[model samples]
Target: MINLHWIILLPIIFGTVVKLLPLKTAKKLMVLFQAVLLVLVFVIFIEVRKNGTILENIGGWPDTISITLRADLLASAMALLTCLLFLAMLTFVQNKHYADHLFFFLFLSLESLIIGIFLSNDLFNIFVLIEAATLIITILIMYKKTNLSIYDGMMYFLINVVAMSFFLMGLGMLYKKIGVLDFYALETALSQVKDPDSMILPYAFMITAVSLKAALMPLFSWLPKAHGTPSAPSEVSAILSGLYVKTGVYLFIRLQLAFSPLINTSELFMVLGFITAIVGFVLAFAQTDIKLLLAYSTVSQIGLIMVGINMGSPQAYWGGLYHIMNHAVFKSTLFLTAGMIITEYKTRNLDEIKGVFNLMPAVGMATVISILGIVGAPLFNGSISKYLISEGSSGSWIEYGLIFINLGTIIVFIKYGQLLFGESGKKETANSDILEKAVVLGLSMLCFFGGIFGSELISILFEVNFPVEILSHGVKLLLFVGSLFLGLVIYYGLFKKKNYLAVLNAIELGFNEICLSITLFFAFMVIYLKITL
Candidate 1:
């Protein structure tokens, strides 16, 4: 098997080399380098499949104390996802005017850091990677350098830096108490510790940081701005939504697992997740700007993914993982195509942007499919993941909560679907770059393929023999159809004429308010664990 360090280092090396080259040469080399990285990630995935889990300590150091890289099913899969999304983004942006060497350099550097986050087993290393990635993403978010962009970027930077301080403090606390930061070692150590309650503060601190990163509830005030800022390029928005935010979810899973023996906050996260989902869609439903709508939609879906993962069932956990992959594909497609549409129409308002089929057939087609996938329409990837998650929570109130979330998802997308009709009012032809069109379409097709073969893919990906009975659950089908029409009724009746919910879109948290939210969230977690534990 290939060394895990190389997978992390090769991209940085390639990016540095590309930065020193001329623009045209740099673009070509960038693609070549990302392809190489993707191949290497695939190899790591294969090796993990064959060997169960691959762990290596840097510089031949011992596992307990050394900086270690661990390749298990989830890590390898996320690494693969990082590479695929990077490669697609690279291809999608190759022909753009702003596709410069510096942009390529930052893009590749961020890719490496994200993959590093996936592979690193050392808590401090993960912290450094996240902090580094946070800086790069802030730059990318404000890459256009407008005054507003600079302000938006700074807001993102300030909030995340504050969040990471908690992470650093928690790391210090763990290292002081346990003297090790490696994931498995910490898990083992915690298992042996007599008083689990003693670790609750550290757990609360670390989880607060991750929850903010995952854009849970009150901490999500920054997500829409960071993701939907006009200064950010479409590809940057795509990466932020499609892959970067997922790092938070990934770390949330890891941190929870490491502390599982000591505490189980599954119930807390589930409630938070459901609230986040509801709030996300309610805000998304009121958006006029297409990109902001998509951004808020991401918040909603992440919450749904959290709900699935914390449903206390193996089926739901795997389904959450699958939905992660599904969201990456469709959301990337939507963001990329939304960029194209905004470019063509010279506006971001959903009401103004119409006749997409006539204006850009390929992008329109991709958008429709992606919307279907996101809405959990039957025979789409979202449906499959929702099915698994729902099946896992059968006969429970959580199952009904899942239903309500899906209904909100459908309603938001139904509002989003308005872009596909009416007139674009422009004389431009649907002559977008063939490569960009192909990338979007490819992602859209994966959404379909994922649904059709979801069962097999889930089994193979997670090494579980879970078969999904789509036809067996006739009620689910009925529920899905019912939700779609009901969503339509709700969208038209409640939202179309005079959107009372539109005021929700204007609500923004000031930096001070956001800080208070983080503190409140931490206090709540600490108190909840105190009462529950």
Candidate 2:
């Protein structure tokens, strides 16, 4: 008998098997396993494209009694991107083996959990996968056993545990009401109900948890500590900023659709997105460490994605979805490049590092391409997707909101771009790997060319026609250039001179404060849902 379940189970089995093998064998096995998983993604992609949505009920039982694995355009596309990304990342760490067997096991397990999330159509499975992912990430974040890493890892773990508690409570409420934990069944059950407001409590609980997972405002401190900390591996940070956070976003979209009939909180999220975007940039500007800068930048980009998807416009929604992929490539590559830079320079301080283009030509060039992509320059992926998002926001206040967010993004990136200039007379500071450099170059090339065919991509992915009209292209480019110029002026004239960055940095909140913030966010959501839904 043919098996469709292998797509979800095979990698997990491989991860479990690796734990029994020797460290060297486990590493090779993982690389091979990742290749197999990537191939499966392609196979599933073709199957999904041809058949629409593929579903598998476990144990050949009734849908209500068994777990379900699902594959659709969104799920398959993300899975494919994720597998390719992880495979490429594995190649980067081929030479530097730290923590030996444990790292590989944890990393592979995390992959399985993420893939499981993409495929599962059951609430319990999704929650379990998320909790599993969170656990694995916390361990990885503390892999080095440094004082800071331990602190950061604990912060991440404790904060997410609290969030997952909210998620579990929501699941309890859901099961109590519908008696089924499956997505389709729950949606069906919810639709048949007369009063949508009766579901508001569970909805608020779940969405709040997902919002925290996405690292929205007031609950995002755990992110920089985990992803931006000096002790986290480059691969760990890359995957977190590039892929894992997108898992939260995926749930955001998925749950939003499943519960659309009950409530529409898109406007609230749109406003929150703008706030996140602005705050993310401001925090980024305050960071002196390059890693922390990129960390906060991830938060800002997620905000932009949130705004695009919540706008209720097809072009914007697809653009946001497409951005999930684009951001993965560019941001992952940037983190990898930063790792290479930090290794070469022996420090993470931005002030001490300069003239990247001259010092490390290959890594520096890739970083340049990545900067272009992140800043939405013409002929880059970010530009096209952002264009779509902005177009969809036109004639609404959201249009202006996006513009301001873009401006803030440019200002912080302006500070980041400074690392690229100056003369090169220095020698090689750290040993380099051909495979690592090659992967960065390849991803950057994708960043560059993905934009050339951006419209075609949008059309194919969402089955919608979003042509890049010349006028729209010209206008967006002009606006981007203006933003770039203004960002430079502000960075040099006011932000740097007035010690604004100092104030933001000094206003740090502790774990207790973060917990308080999470509580406040949930309470506010509960009240808002009650009034609106």
Candidate 3:
């Protein structure tokens, strides 16, 4: 009979307890802890789905005065994903040499903080948890202490510190106006207010931070460095790309919905999303580093997800949510597999590494499945989510924009697919752990079948009957196939013929540069939102 309130406490307590244990004992304890957490999250999910929502004001205090946590379908689902992803990471890292002290401490603490961010009903708590998570992640990112990793970690820290300052300022403003930071309480306060204009700046402040975290355009300067640094381990990169960033997206959904009665900026966000998506793929196309290419691809996929959710269509909203899950699975698998490939080849350059299929057949096969999913091949997870997102914008420019952006993604991957061909070079074998391989391959299969039975899976995951239209009777199939062919042509015919992409590779933003970009974006958002929303 454990309620939602105890769920947050369980992780935080165990995470702290692990800090005191010996290294070997900590690892053993962690497995047990993760098992308990998985069970707890499952139980919470069941209870939430059964009851619709679970609200707990701590210590049985009055709702008006006490801090509260909520467990609805969305929050519970996200929490469950967090648990599953954390466990997957542990299994991946278990045999790695870096599984030393502070590894468990940082990961477990970060895990609890993330779950808290998802579950907490109070804005103040969310802010604190996010800041804590950022600090821990920064430390983890710089863990290897190799090749500019310290610099990358510092940049990540400085940029996010500024972002959190924005969040804090906005939280202060909201508290001044509403006298409470609880989501429901804020809504209640807004209901009694006459002026909604005061919220625009606060929204700008908060959303800018969340947007930075989500690595949206302009503020996306930190993402490539942090997620693709040569020093950051594969699991760290995978977790950052696969899960940490989504917490920001989660906050965006939560805060925006709470302010729906005040204003709607979905249209502006849709436009911004399109720009981000296009830019993301274009930048990815110019990259030679496989990990960086994947990092940029994440930016592209996130933009598409942002576009989906902002489209004022329920089909799009659900599609966006579905894509979040899909992106997590496939992207993590790609990053992990890419990490292995990079290790085996002893290089990060996409062109230098070849014949993964011959060298590591399982890894190569996983890459093919992951690529198909990312490129939205029929009966893959990406296709289902992409099609649903398209359904919402059926005839608009946004739909067309998705096609164009996807073309860019296809071109990048077409270049990336080169690794699967050519000669399997001479190199000594390394221990390929059965567990890590199984986890990633299993996830790839989930992507495969998840698309084949998308409607059923969607109903199970979301508890709603979602009609999944695949290729829309060959119309979408034609478009995707055309894009793939065109992308390949552009890659070989146009890109290969020129040095133009070199300039794109040189565009790296510094800390001050990122700060300026954030300022410009905030100002633009304020002016534009004032005029429009």
lDDT of each: 0.90, 0.86, 0.85
Instruction: Give the alpha carbon lDDT tens digit for every residue of 1-533 in model 1.
Output: 68999999888888888777788888887888888889988988988888899998898888987889999999999999899999999999999998887888888889889999999998899999999998999998888889878888999999999999999999999888998999999899999989878898899899999999999987899999899998699999999999999999999999999999899999889888999999999899889999999999999999999998998998888889999999999999999999999988889988888899888999999999999899888888988888888888888999899989999989888888888888777778678999899999998998999888888887767788777664745778899899988988988887788777877866888889999999999999899989998
Candidate 1 TM-score, true structure as reference: 0.98
Report the CA-based lDDT of candidate 1 relative to the real structure. Answer: 0.90
Clashing pairs in 3: none
Better of 1 and 2 by lDDT: 1
TM-score for all models, in order of appearance = 0.98, 0.96, 0.96
Task: State which candidate has the highest TM-score.
Answer: 1
Q: After superposition, how far is residue 369 of candidate 2 from its true place, in Å?
A: 0.6
Model 1 backbone overlap count: 0
Error of 1 at 1 (Å): 2.0
Q: What residue runs in model 3 are displaced by over 4 Å at the alpha carbon? A: 16-25, 427-431, 470-473, 497-499
Q: Deviation in angstroms for 277 in model 2?
A: 0.8
Clashing pairs in 2: none
lDDT of 3 by residue, 1-533 (tens): 67666666676677677778777777767777787789889988888878788888888877757878888888898899888888877777777788775777788778888888899998888988888888999999899887599989988988999999999998999888788888987877877767777888888899899899888887787899999999788988988898888998899999888888877888878888888898898888888899999999999998999999999988888889989988988898899999888878899998798888888878888999999999999889998889889888988988888889889889889888989998867564445678778778877897898689877767767887767544473798899999998988888888866636768888888888899898888888799778875
Give one clash count per candidate, in the order shown: 0, 0, 0
- Displacement of residue 472 (Cα, Å) in model 3 is 1.6
lDDT of 2 by residue, 196-306 (tens): 877888888898899989989877888889898798999999999999999999998889888877788999998898889889988998888899999999999999999
Candidate 1, pairs of clashing residues? none
